[model samples]
Target chain A: MEKTVVIPTDFSIASLNIVKSYVSMQPANARLNIILLHGLHQSDSIRSLLFYSKHRMMEELCSKEFKEACYVLKNKFASQIKTMKSDLFSGFTQSAFNQYTEANNIAEVCLPVLYNPKFKNKNSFDLLPYIKASKLPVEMVGSEVDVPMPEKGKVAELFFNRVSVS
Target chain B: MKMRIQIKTTLILLTAFLSIILMFSGFVYLSVSNYSYEDFYKLLEIRAVTTAKVELDQEGGSQEMIALRNEFFEKLPQEKDRYYRISPGESFKNEAEELGVPISFFNEIVKEGKSEYTKNSMFYKGIRYKSKQGEYVVIASAQNYFELHHSAYLRRTLVFAIIAAFAFSALIALYFSRYVFRPLRKITDRVKEISSENLHLRLDNNSNNDEMSDLIGTFNNMLDRIETSFETQNNFVSNASHELRTPLTAIIGEADVTLSKIRTTDEYIETIKVILDEAETLDRKTKALLFLAQTGFNGKTQKFDKLRIDQLLWDVKETIEKINTNSRIHIDMSLLPENPVKLKIKGNEQLLHLALSNIISNACKYSNNNVVNVSIGASDQNVFIIVKDHGIGIPEKELKYIYDPFFRASNTLKYEGYGIGLPLTRNIIRIHNGEILVSSIVSQGTTVQINLPVGKFEE
Candidate 1:
């Protein structure tokens, strides 16, 4: 049986480091299916909700650099990784998360220990709280290799600078 | 034989509108039907639970409580109630048959709290009520008369509305199409009134920046081009005839004067020389005119071959040297591409030779035998040829008309030319898909730049 792993991502290149660390700990002969999940709020308009499409979301969400990075990772782990695909989790409720996990047959949730999810667009939100509250076993992978994260909004940067200087 | 655009547009609009109205009506009917079904089922379920509470919970089926329940709620059409006493582990197969429902309905009500079934506009709501007396299955069945009659009315109304909407939309579509296409019809009528005789007539271009105005602007631009080219053609014909007639008149006059009386051999020889010179000029003019006409067509009379542009330039230089020995022309090949394939282009060698030779010879003629520098260069997409002459350049005001056949600059009257060379060269270059740009300053020089697409190498 293939062990499918779900990793919540912000679509940055650094997010893949958690996936890399998780894969490194797995058995060499184990077959793996990697699902990179992103939290995207569905359109509130009835017309858009009626005609919702995930393929369109993927095109709008995935950047060129992010796709290239995923391609490189897939190739680098071709021996153990059977398939790699991205999916959107649009629900905000815990039951919805449970349904998503059940639908995808997710065995476990892997996340970075000290990671803050980045919203690529206005419709995106933090999915970590839902994942944390779910019944699935959550494994926290340490970002000990020090992946460079992009800076957030100016307010957070100002707060950080003041605190560090003081 | 063909339908008019206005009719087609109206039909298209009507079809789109009808489809939208039909879809909207269908959606409304489906939702209303769904709402009636759910509402009837909920009402039946409430009645079943209330009756179960009264009969099972009250001591011995109280008549007063039933009367009170009846007084508060309106009676549903053909309402009936059934209660079955439950025995542990006893299959309800017989009860299912008696109730005219599948056994799954009983099993669902037993497992889940309640279940509903529908058959022929009749709704059945079954509930499992556990009271102090015992566990009982109470099912309330009713005919949804309101739903049955209201749906029939709704269906009739929807069909009538759809038909009425179709007719109304068709009328609106016709009017809208007429309003939209009125200007187009006017433009068409105006266009029909214009002919080659009245090429200057243009449609009125209003100030609106809509599609109609764009079309009018485009049509007006087309008319401008037609009028300009027509004028050029007329000018070319008259100029060519005059240029041809001048030499013919000279030859005829000289011959007539010479033959008027007998004269000495030297005098006869002098007369023949003058006639020969005139005939030679006429021959040159006729040949140049013929070549100009031939090159005017786009690759009609010529066969294109992939030839190296540098080699073609060299051939043209050799031909020019042979024609005018005193004409000093230099070919600069310093900018040649390392890949020789970049230097290749698809062109007719003969026409190309004619074109390049014309430019060089003119340079020699106009510059009074000054050295002309011809350089060749290539980029990834195109090859460029630059020909420079340190000659008495064309006047600034006359540069635009230099390509007109038999149009010569004022200062070029001393130079022997019928003004056919530049126009012929331009035609040849155009047929080869090359651009020619001539920039000149009087008494200094003229530079002609020719840019042609580089030929791709096929496997």
Candidate 2:
């Protein structure tokens, strides 16, 4: 059976690296489904722009970035790749992720550890405790290096061995 | 040697402020120090993980790892970060072992997967990482030089701040003490200027209504009492001298006239009689004065016995009747309690008799009719004696002064009195812990009520 995996992103390059590192580490015979979850954190300016023409505003804000990420993910992985967006302007990201994972039959979650020098004492995201408290298996990928393109074979073997044991 | 009230209060306030400031500063210092330690430990943990990633990875050789290590070293050169790689089976030869951290501490880190602690002011964080290479324990440590320097600087600044604060507090306290006691100083100066000649001088009390004003008011009230007492003493001395000299002069004149010429037996007898009358008047006045003096003294040595108040009044009536056969003094026992104990009172019997006789005799002498009625009654706590007379009562205004020695009512000038009776009677009653109340209307009547505490019965 093909297993669906969820990756929550903040549209940062660090988050994209985590997905790339995780996907490249899968085995050859492993059948997997990948979901890229984006939570929309709309500012007042974006909200006003959306209020005028939501369809056009969304296309203008997300078209280029989303397309490039999708193209990269598709080219890197043989598994099915899907994209999802949630209106997180009203609620917490953890709740939105939980709801998306449940609806999409997500078997596991992958997150990135991104270091912020400005906030060395604070967490980059407040989602780990929520994910740990949930009934889902979770993995963390380190984003210390800025690798534009990672070796697919190396990442694939690494992730395949790690996920297979658990 | 003795601190003024303002100084004392200012010192107390300053002490309280300093105490609060010290507590708050201590809490702040502790919190900042704790946060600094936490941040240091986090940095050490990150360094440990990054070192493991760069050094232990098989795919990334020494070249890339060396470059990464250089980048890490260049970024945080001031950190003075150190690392010790220990193999579990080895003899534990490392710089960390040399740093004197117990070998058991590293063992605990390996067992628990990770541990962080501070030893000798140096933060130590150890992590056990397993890679394809081998099982390795990475112990990272650094002297928190930045935190230590920051704390030291904070300590120096706090010391200076505390000293400055104390000096400022002393200055403020001096100013506050002076400001608060300004009114008291004025009052003291004014009081010091006043002597016997300026007894009429008073403190200025028209200031803001506060405790200081209350103090000034109390002082002025005390001065008023003292001045009144002084005037009364002066008046008493003058009046007593005049009263004593009058009878003495009359007796001297009679004796001189009798001796100036030889007289017949009848004439001599008449002169002798005149002298005797003046002598008797002088003797009575002297005796009354002596008794008044005794009662005015502290009654600690006075003998007290429980005596029935009703029986004492009857004795007074009998004595007055014997002195003057025409005096009609009646003792009314209608309100007397059936229980004889209720009428009992603690007093010096002789003094009580003298007091009652004075009131009864005065009533008989001043009444239109020579009739004085004395009633005896009792309450739960006291015995009451009411002496009522249809006399030429004192004037309303003069009633207050009736208890003043030698103070006579305007209407009573026609009556023969040295004006010592009421004051003497009042003193006698007060020594026995009793109150005497007199109410009268001119040409109508006068009533004197004496209330004395009921005596406790002894077994």
Candidate 3:
């Protein structure tokens, strides 16, 4: 059975450790779906609301470093993780948060204990309070190791130079 | 040229400030002068209408009314009044000449009831009044002394302010231009001090993140490349001369010794063989040096075509077979991606062939006829070629100099090579935007890995 786990992300290199923490708790060779959730305030004006697009928001929120970090995580956990996707959460109330989790088919919520997301945009908000208020079971994972900020050099080392002599 | 930049900046600022200042001063002067002219005309018109009311309406003018008018109204400077009565269809030609007024002035009053005109500093007005008497024309003339004085004062003040503003703006523009160009001045002086002997010196970039700092950074990076190439060229020239001399010296010494003493036929044959061996070494070194120099240029004068790396590898193996008949070489292609397009790379085929052949043949030659395994593989972005040789490997200390021209491993003294092959191959690979890495354990083997970016197929 495939289980979907929702992990909060700030699109930072450090936030990717949540995936590592969650994957460590799963059974060996168990297929799982991972959702990286970022919280943002939705446009309230009528015109903007009518023209809202999730893909454009993802492009703005997911930076080059964040995208590479996601690729590295997915590749490293390809066997146990079936799919990893990014999602935007724009809810202000606890009831809306409950609906979003159910709609995404999230079976469990994994929150980082040490990580506080640094919002990249002005409209970004912290989703921890809404997730805590929801009625779903939440697992607080500790991710203490701080990944060094991935520069161009670090990203190249991860993407290329993975030569295995087999 | 440098001073012209500063002067140009100053001129631009001055022109902008001057235009704005001139416009403002001109507006003030024009408005004040217009108000003074209108005020003086209104004073004359009011006087003319009042004279008509007091003189014509009073019928020869009551003594008490005249006295009251004289007491209430202060006389203007050079004020004069004239009254004339004329019937319908009559022109005041004689009266106008006598009063120094044009005939049009009187005609205008008769037609419009009132009119005002000015000549020099004198103001005039005429009003037509009718009662029991025939139509009457009352003319009022005055010299507007107060208005003339006010206008003169305004003109003087405006000219003074404009002169002062011109000087102030010139000073400010000059100072601002100097402040903006101080950094540029320092940069020029520092640049003037640098020469080929001081290529290691770099401009300081301590300022904030701005265009000036960006320029300095770019300049320093350029210097870095220049210094590296200069050192390489200097090293190549010195090493080439020394390597060439060693072979010629050996051949010359053998020839000289053979000619100095007569010997047996066998001895003469041995001497000739030694001389011939040294000559052959000289010939090989010259050809290798020539090839190295020819391939030193990047991409220019070379034709690049889309080449399948696997096919190129096969061609290299075949070429090595023609050169070294006893060489043992095996190619492993299992690691290659299923898509043949991944193996395609845009490169000069001859250069690639030379580069790959150099490595493969060296591997077979160094390993003493042992099997050399060559593997071809590809990832999404790059194609990989790995050549493994079981031979007396390079010393760890000397591995760094392998890319230097005329640099050879200390353990490979017995092998016949001029040490130009590896550097030439590296240059060819770099032209293709590829990287080569060598790792080895002394006395065990050496593994060489080359990666080239994949090419796009033509549409």
Candidate 4:
């Protein structure tokens, strides 16, 4: 059995770095589908990149820059990527990513959202809808240094002057 | 030092005992003295009545009376216990020998009293008497009082006894205090000797399971944690060294391989280009690792100056854009505020620069030609900066371990690193007493949120 994963992104460097990390996490035999998404600011509400692409999204496919980016991704992930014209991004990136992330049997692994400050309006999470729709487990990872749990002997030092309530 | 309860109790007991002895001695001395005076007075009254009756009123003339009185007084020398004075017409004198019974008895019998009485004078205890029939006054003084001498000896002995008791109690106090505090003081000295270099050493345990034992127990638990922390730190250090060594070796080996060939300038420049890139990478990783470690050791060790965050963000973006690349990496910046979003923060500018650059570089390395978006501005209450990328998002589980030392996610090897960039960034932000947060998805992208303090506690 072959396992496939989906990567949803906002087309930013940080999000692309995440894609590289995803490439590293894949097993030797596992394959991946790089889904490049951008959410758009719909007139009334948030819409995914799928919606914006369907509506021709300010003529994104006609833009040479976008076309070139699509060509490069297609060339890089020729066997492992699926280029879609979908506005899964609510503003232009994250909302479309949220939709594909929820599609069942879509992938064995899926990336939820890669936020760019210019694209993301707020820091609060509204991903429960996506989580409920996507029946698969999501696992987040970081370098050991970014981990927040206090390691051995760290609790006392961190809370050296703390008076615990209980 | 605690007051030894036993010594205090003993002192109180000793003080009570001595007080009782002094009170009893005073009562006994007063009683004896009073009895001695009363007995002498009774004797004088009896002698005066008997002598006056026989000499003056028993059919005796004045000359015969005086001769008889003189004869009685002459016999007083044999008693060696009394002095008698017979003053005629208030002119009292000692008829036997010493005149007027020391003048003290004369004053008492004639000038101060009209009746027989006993009183104390300069050197003697005495009784005074007046005879109406002979118009004479007799004053008899005691040659020696025994109670005064006894009480004086007793007072001297008691003073010496009190001094001896105080000295003995002090010795007892010293011995008891040492006995009580020996274990505790020893443990204190032992605890002071423990340091970061040797956290494995423990407090020496005694057989006693007292309060100090509880403290030792807690300290032992702390030692367990320190051991684990040291192990983690060691792993981090080794992992960093290994990560750094790989690139360094690669850079040197690549340069060596290139130079070994006879090549033209263009070929040489091309080969050196790759080597230069590798060297740059090793340098970046090494620098990030050191910065992270330094922050870990002490946050306050670094001096902070005022920083303009808006300018810093713009500067980073400008520098990144200016770097020569194949247009593979790009940045799209936005400022929400109409103004330049001036924010004054207190922090080490160097650390801030390093942290921001590392994040931006990480974004560039993994984005596969995607754009890095950065936004910086200040809200009324806070200053915030966000760096986001459309690269791969982190796994939910691995995100928690990102800040731990030397730990990298399973997917993080694609871009070679010592895995300390984010940690370094975080530590620097924390030194400024600020916070950084993140949210990401597999392919959608990742966003890093940074909030720095503005000298909140200077007052």
Candidate 5:
């Protein structure tokens, strides 16, 4: 049976790198499914554009920096990816994520341990506390960089490791 | 050396302040240390959970886990003693020697789910983590280095703060005590300067209207009374000497005249009678002077007993009549109370008799065979004796001076008196805690009233 992993994303390059690094580190010939989820706090116009028409909204989503990130993921890991977006007001983010995992039969939840500039001293995943509290087995993947975000027009260092949780 | 009030007050205030500061510092130290330990324990729990996630994930090898541990967690010097163990059963092989943890301590952690303690200045926290693979116990310990260093810094800062606060408090107390007692010191200096020669001088009270001003005002009033008393005493001594010398001069002059020549039996007898009369006057004046001196010196030495004032008045009347058979003393007992206790007074009987006789005889002597009215009355709190005379009455201007020893009315030069009677009577009545009131009208009459407190006696 193919193993499925759930990943929450904010559509940023750093988030995309986290998913790519996690998938590439897996053993070769091991069939895996990756779900990229976006929990959105969208305005009425954006919500209507996405819900009312799919093709137009898809074109809009493919226009900006998000298009480059999605394009990179497709070229690298073709036919092994799925993407979904949800409005935050419809349900709690954690509950929605849990339901999505259950429906997809996800083997584990993979969370990106992104650095927050405000908390410069701590070097841990942003979602580490939530994943530890959750019932599901979750892995926090991140790199060790003193700075969280890359300089303008520069790429951040990418490394991946699974965090152990009790 | 005796401690000043300022120093005493400052020390007391500083002691109290230091006690409170010490207590507060202790409480803060205890609370901060406790919070630090609790926070450290929470960090250890997070470390253990993160370690389990990396080691048991099945996807990441030990090299990746080690790399992640190196990247995120800082290695402690005592890291060898910190470790986690997983077992399939309730018991596991002893790892105490390797982990430097007691076997019993591990058992306690497994049974209780969590355990925390401190030994040799190092804090240890252990937790049991249950998973599908097996139950695992994670025990972590390290020296409380950060907490101890922080606490030491805190202790030094608190010590300096307490010392500074006490020093400031002592200075403040000294200033406060001096400010508070400034008025008392001023009054003391002013009082020290006053003497009998300058009894008229008074303290300056033009400052704040507080208790200090009241004390100064009261002292000034006392000085006024003392000055008046001194003036009266000076007058009494001069007058008494003149009065005593008059009778002595007359007795000596008559004796010299009688001894200068011999005469017939009738002539000698007449000369002797004159000498006897002058001697009797001298003896009477001397006795009155003696009584006045004794009453002034030791009024308390006289024994006192309860005596009815009316009976005392009757005795005076009898004594006066014996002295002057032709003198009229009318006793008016109409106003006397039915209850004899109301007329009772506490006094030495001899002094009361002497005071009454002096007043009664003076009334008869001054009235010149006129009816000398003696009235006895009683009130709820006192017995009143009124002696009324209608002879040569005293001048109104001399009424206040009547109680002075040897004081005499200017119009009473022809009256036979040494002027010691009223003053002696006043002193006697005063020692018995009674009052003497005299009201007189020139050429009309004089009235003397004596009020004595009603005496209490057993049934």
Candidate 6:
């Protein structure tokens, strides 16, 4: 069965390149799909525009932000995960991933921190417990600012010699 | 005489040289020839008139009254003689001889009263006779003449013609020199062909010394400099590529291995550790490589300081002792100054220590059962340090590459090293304007020598 990852967020496309790099390195047959869902930040943006809304456009706005992020990821990927509603999808947010991990007794990748800087210093935020308990490997998505992979042989060796992991 | 430069140049100068000599010689020759002909004619005219006056004064005004006419009658200027009689009363015994006197000669002086003469001598009885009035003959002769007696002038014009031909030929020689030097076209063509790859090929500058030789020399020197820079650039790129490879491979390998399979906690941690380890190694190697590359680019930072020799060595010795309790490294400091060897050279002490420590550590590590020896002493010009080890010494060929960054000898692979230690040590020493040398033979032993400049160590 394909391994499913839930990318919960008020998603931004800033990290799309990193996702693309990951997908390229994957095995051809690997069935890795992302479950993207917008969290409460979508609600916050929606509530801010509530005065002018003639209809229930808040749901539409949240869905739009979610869909756009998914579209960017899909263009770089072979196939993508279709969004499941709140009952099955667990609303997309860091809080949702935490809830999903605890409830399902499975590891959920901690991605919510990308949405807010205010909670960054707090080590006890949503992903820490899941990371500690999870048996599977967790890959923190690299930012676009990370250096590109170099050519093989000497170039590869030189990069390794000079810029090893911190 | 040894020709001076101006003299040599004067001899070789083409312009106005032969022209001056030709003009002077031709002027002298023409003046002398003209003066001699003029003097001959004036003397002839003066003598002729004087002789006629003397005769007229002596013998009254007629030919019959002249003594020469009476003497000629007493002797009778006849056919046996080769002289002519000009008197009308004179008698001739031989009528044939009388007819032999040329009518042209008689008419020349008597009938026409003209001083004209034929070039051929007249014959009396088939024998040639001289005419006394030959001076009366007039001929336009000599190429250019002053007055009478210039018959040579018309025939001598050939001399002037020959001279003019010679001078014209000299002028042609000068023109030939100007025309033949058309080689500047070839010289410039070859010069334009020069490039970095063929900088060693220079202009064939074997021609005469002039602006062209100097120009070729300057271009050849410029090519030398360009060639050096080209080599430096080539070396930089080659070294840079070689240095960049390690870190990248580790990053990919680590990430790829982790991405391969699902693992338990311990296995996952172990895998991540390898990845992280490789990353760290890459970082270190990259830093070293960058430092080495940049150092090589401009120059090594020698910026030295006054280092307390004994104190620094003691500190190093103490530090090494702490790292390994049983390492066989013996410090023999008997020759050092009692008060701390206060040799404050302008140098980088920390880097110097790094270099020394690397050397000392290697000696200790490579030694067998024997203890490695370290010494510090000084001469008037330079400080000396010897690090000698009786260990698995390096082979002759391997010793050459010790100072090259990342060049690990094939034999030294058993010992853990990236081979950067010696290169780093060498660089540090080099920055201090110092030299480091190693001499080793298989199983025999190894000795390292260090030489530092005396007081100009600040560089």
Q: Please, what are the lDDT tens digits per residue for candidate 2 over residues A17-103?
A: 556567556665566676655434344576675676545544543434334334434433534333433222223656766675687
- Fill in the DockQ of model 4: 0.01
For B1-459, candidate 4 gives per-residue lDDT tens digits of 897565665566566656765686668667866786566556555555555455445563666766766676544321223434454554444442353334545566555543443334312323344444435544344333443465467567667766776677566656766676677678778878888887778887775788878888888877755654464466666646764775677677768887787888988898778778767767766775666555453466676777778677765565455342532333322222333323667777667876787677667766764776665544434556666677776776788777766677777677667676676566567667777776666566666767675443332
Q: Which stretches of candidate 1 lie over 4 Å from their true place?
A: A1-166, B34-64, B76-296, B305-346, B379-381, B395-398, B406-418, B454-459
lDDT (tens digit, per residue) of candidate 1 on B86-165 = 88899899988887889999888888979989888788999999989889889999999767699999999999999999
- Listed per model in order, the count of residue pairs whose N, CA or C atoms clash below 3 Å is 0, 5, 0, 78, 3, 48
Please compute DockQ, using alpha carbons, for every candidate against the native two-chain complex.
0.01, 0.00, 0.06, 0.01, 0.00, 0.00
Question: What proportion of the true contacts does each candidate reproduce?
Answer: 0.00, 0.00, 0.00, 0.00, 0.00, 0.00
Task: Give per-residue CA lDDT, model 3, range B162-249, as digits (tens).
Answer: 8999999999999999999998999889988989898878899999999999988988877865665554466676546654675577
How well does candidate 4 score on lDDT at residue B253? 73
Model 4: which docking level applies? incorrect
lDDT of 2 by residue, B1-459 (tens): 988688788888789768876887788788888888888788888888777777675574767776867866535323444444556566554554676777776777768988887766777788888777777777677778656688999878787887788788878877887888888789889999989888889988788899988998898877865665555455556545644665687778778888899889999899888778768766766665555444443556677888988788877787667456689877765445556776788887777877888888889989944677777666556566777777888888888999766789999877878777677677678778788878777876777877787888964
Task: Assess each prediction's global lDDT (C-alpha) against the native.
Answer: 0.77, 0.66, 0.76, 0.54, 0.64, 0.49
Cα error of candidate 6 at position B400, Å: 3.3
CAPRI tier for the interface of model 2: incorrect
lDDT: worst 10-residue window of model 1 chain A: A157-166
- Two-way lDDT contest, 4 vs 5, winner: 5
Q: What is the lDDT of residue A17 in candidate 3?
A: 61
* TM-score order of candidates, top first: 3, 2, 5, 1, 4, 6
lDDT of 3 by residue, A15-117 (tens): 6666766776788768889998988999799999898999998998887646755654554566778899999988888888889999888998888767556
B195, model 6: CA deviation in Å?
11
lDDT of 5 by residue, A87-132 (tens): 1212345775556557777687776555331211122124333334
Q: Candidate 4 on A22-51: residue-level lDDT in tens?
A: 544555445555544444445543555335
Clashes of 3: 0
Per-candidate chain B TM: 0.57, 0.67, 0.64, 0.45, 0.61, 0.42
